[model samples]
Target: MLHDLGGLLFIALGLVLVAAGFVWQGGALRPLSTKRAQAAAMRDRSRNLLRSADMAIAEARRRAARDEPAIVTVEDVTRVACRHYGHLFVEREEAAAALRQRYEAADCRVDCMTDAFN
Candidate 1:
């Protein structure tokens, strides 16, 4: 009977340790999941900015084709993106910087360093 009791006590301790290990693992994974979510959000923001800049470029091209005084310049991509996604940025400078990066990638004529908006 004593031997049986000893075995049961060992089993109980083993089970407790296993449960603790699971809890620790769960805690560790939580931060990883949070970081993944943050990265996903950042990617989505970048995609949206790029799409907006592309659309602005296309609109400018269409106007030039029609010989209509181009209402939107390549530099205006930043302004257009900011108008749509302004809330995503913490500051005007941040919005300008992000939009300008996207605009340059989309082949805007103005250099990122010189263009105030694009």
Candidate 2:
């Protein structure tokens, strides 16, 4: 009877440990999932910016090569690029600024130079 009780106790302990592990894993995964979603959003924003830039550059090149009185300049290209991608750029900048403000408010230090380098 004592041996049976000991075996039951071990099983219960094991089950408790397994449950605790799952709970811990769930808690840890939530933050990771959130970070992943943020990262995906950032990637999508960047892709949109690049696509807009590409379209603007192509349009500018086409305009420049055309036989027209108005020749497209570098400034015109830049303006067009900004106009095309302005929304995405502004959103990304806003998100970054908000993140920076939150980090500063929390007294968390960020490597700004490293971010600029990237």
Candidate 3:
């Protein structure tokens, strides 16, 4: 499933780039810029975090049927997602200057910590 998703992402990205090249004056293919690659990696990591949460929640649900105390709530999955994805954005609030810049560019808030996503 992961491999298929990755292949799709690359194919979509390739199609977009081709369209962009033709729309612009020159139809030349170029390597992704450092910032573009980093952004893509960040999104992929975020997606992976969500996927992990989905799997965890599903497992918890399966267990919940047999055990009453093992119920998985949205908070549980969201916290898991936030913690994992937050680390990718900024491991430390005070020191993640680059990440903060990216967030600002995207017009979104990315405060350091799991609370942002949660």
Candidate 4:
């Protein structure tokens, strides 16, 4: 009878240990799940920004090819900056200044009058 009782106690102890291990593993994975969610959000945002930038550039190219005036706007400047630098985390003034410089230097615009006609 004592031997049988000891076997039952050992089995109970094993079950408890297994349950504890599962709980610990679940706790460890919670933070990983959060990180994955944040990463997915970031990836989605990047895709959207890239899509917008591509569309803007395409439109500009179309206009330039047609020998039409393509006025670059603030949004266009930001999109260009995002295309090159991912997302701007700089101060408003600094980012604006930097993006303005990038926009000015970019050959994104062709000489429509010369290139398209000639």
Candidate 5:
């Protein structure tokens, strides 16, 4: 009788361990998926920013070539760059806001602490 009880206890303990493992894995996987999605999104955003910057530079060069003004100043290039960057900033802000909303919904943390540090 005692042997049978020991076997039953062992079986119960094994079942509990298996259940705990599944629960732990499920919890861990949720965060990993969120992180992977965030990373992919960030990469896509960076690629878009780079493409926009390249196009803006090309357009500026084309404009300058066509205009052929008497004086081509650094300010001219800077003005065009600022305009390009401003548009990019607006788009990036919108994307970031959307991501933040998603993260909040998932109960995940968004690391915007850099703004505070700066």
Candidate 6:
């Protein structure tokens, strides 16, 4: 009876592992949350991204005021975002894009952080 129980336990564990493998391979075991919940979560994520972008931009402005290095490199902007809001949600490209738009809107020719990358 003990041997039979052990065999059954092994079989159960194997099935669990197989299911996990399928899920890992994109077997559509995605979070079964409501659409409204997913939308709200996406909105929150966007808000966090915006806030991080704003914080990074503000840091760039402070650095400008200091007249230290006139050059706001991508690394500098990324570091500022990571310092305040962590790096997971901070997209350097997106932040740079926003900065370019804002700067150009005011007819300014300031070199952007992404210019170094280009």
The ten-residue window of minimal lDDT in model 4 covers 109-118
Q: Which runs of model 3 end up more than 4 angstroms from their true locations?
A: 1-28, 66-118
Please provide, for model 5 over 1-118, each residue's C-alpha lDDT reduced to its tens digit, 9 standing for 90 to 100: 9999999999999999999998787564435587899999777755544444344334544555443522222233334434655533434343344333433443332221111111
The candidate maximizing lDDT is: 1
**TM-scores for candidates 1 onward, in order:** 0.42, 0.34, 0.37, 0.36, 0.32, 0.41
Candidate 1 TM-score, C-alpha based:
0.42
Over 41-111, each residue of candidate 2 has an lDDT whose tens digit, in order, gives: 78876565445434433454455534433222333323543676565234434333433333344333321
lDDT of 5 at 11: 100
**Top candidate when judged by TM-score against the true structure:** 1
lDDT of 3 by residue, 1-118 (tens): 9999999999999999988878896744896799999999877765654454454445554665442533434444445555655543323332233333333343433221222222
Q: Supply the global lDDT for candidate 6.
A: 0.58
In Å, residue 43's CA in model 5 sits off its true spot by: 0.3
For model 1, residues 3-113, the per-residue Cα lDDT tens digits are 999999999999999999887875644355878999998887777666765676566666564434334443465566667767334344644565566556755554222
lDDT to native, each model: 0.61, 0.48, 0.50, 0.53, 0.46, 0.58
lDDT value, candidate 4, whole model: 0.53
- Residue-wise lDDT of candidate 4 within 1-91, one digit each (tens)? 9999999999999999999988787564435587899999777755554454445545565666355665544466355546755665423
Query: In candidate 6, what are the lDDT values of residues 5-112, reduced to their tens digit?
Result: 999999999999999988788655667679879899767755554555455555666666443433445455556556765655556676565445544553334533
Weakest 10 consecutive residues of candidate 6 by summed lDDT: 108-117
The predicted structure with the larger TM-score, 2 or 4, is 4
lDDT of 6 at 12: 100
Q: Considering only N, C-alpha and C atoms within 3 Å, which residue pairs clash in candidate 2?
A: none
| Candidate 1 global CA lDDT score | 0.61
Order the candidates by lDDT, highest first: 1, 6, 4, 3, 2, 5
lDDT of candidate 2 at residue 7, scale 0 to 100: 100
Q: List the pairs of residues colliding in candidate 5.
A: none
